[model samples]
Target: MELISSDKRNQLFERFAHDAFHLELRDDYSVPNEVGPFEDWLNGRESDDSFMAPWLQLMKRVTESGKTVRRVRVVTEPHSPYIQWEHATTNVNEEAGELIRWLPRHKLPAGLHFPVDGNDWWLFDDKLLAVGHFDDGGRVLGSEIIDAPEIVAECIRVRDLLWSIATPTNEYQL
Candidate 1:
């Protein structure tokens, strides 16, 4: 299957109407842009979050236009360092208009199964999906675009189920 570059995948955000939802299933993410910030946090230094400016801006623009952007992060009970950092910074995301929730992996509904081979995905308007792909080391390798009705349907089902049970970031404790 062909995968589109992250830039191309982000372009979908512009075309999608109504809403966009992201399902995050990883304990840690090794995004290159986040390397420095993550390290700084680990070392007890003040980490700069300028890297997120663009994404924050995009989210602001989208939500201001009446579109909703949301995400459900399913994580292990003992959060990874990256996840801890993500949690601390989530308020900025919310301030920018994104709705983020956290779900402890153990709390997931019984018998819940992930679609698209258990990969992370972004569902746009309940119609399109940009499924994230990663390299051996967990760095992102772009995303595969899938719009098949059956697949999109399954993702939508999972999204609704997970969203219902996940705790909103503000209320979720470390």
Candidate 2:
């Protein structure tokens, strides 16, 4: 698998034609840029989300261009601290034009299987997938693209199903 730059992975958002969808399965993400923000949250500080400005800007630009951006996060009922922080800060994403939803693990239909390598991913335009790789400590290790029709199709199916069942951000509190 080839490791692609995070910038390139994010660049797909600008180039996609119809819709962009992301599936988040992890309980934690120890991204370097987020470390400080997470720490602030843990210390009872409000999330400024300044670090997310660039991506938020892109989301606004793309959505304003008539494209769609959505994400579904499958989280445990008693979410991890990271997820709590993410949930607390999700308004920023929504305000910037990304629609996010959450699904509790227990609410997921039994026997459901995720597509591809079973990691978190972004499926763009129903043609390409960018899957994230992580270490045991939850730090990101970049991502790679998959364009095979069978794999992409399965991912699309999984995405649609999860999105259908996820609770919209506004409908959820916590």
Q: Per-residue lDDT for 27-139 in model 2, tens only? A: 88768899899999999986678999999899999999999999999998788899999998888899988999999988888999887667999989999999988777777
Q: Which residue pairs in model 2 clash with each other?
A: none
Q: Candidates' lDDT values, in order?
A: 0.94, 0.89
lDDT of 1 by residue, 1-174 (tens): 898998899899899999999999999886889999989989999899899999999999999999999999999988888899999989889999999999999998889899999999999999999999998889888899999999999999999999999999989999
- TM-score for each prediction? 0.98, 0.96
Worst 10 residues of 2 by lDDT: 133-142
- TM-score for predicted model 1 compared with the true structure: 0.98
- Please identify model 1 stretches exceeding 4 Å from their true place: none
Superposed model 2: Cα runs more than 4 Å off: none
Tell me the alpha-carbon RMSD of every candidate.
0.7, 1.0
Best by TM-score: 1
Best by lDDT: 1
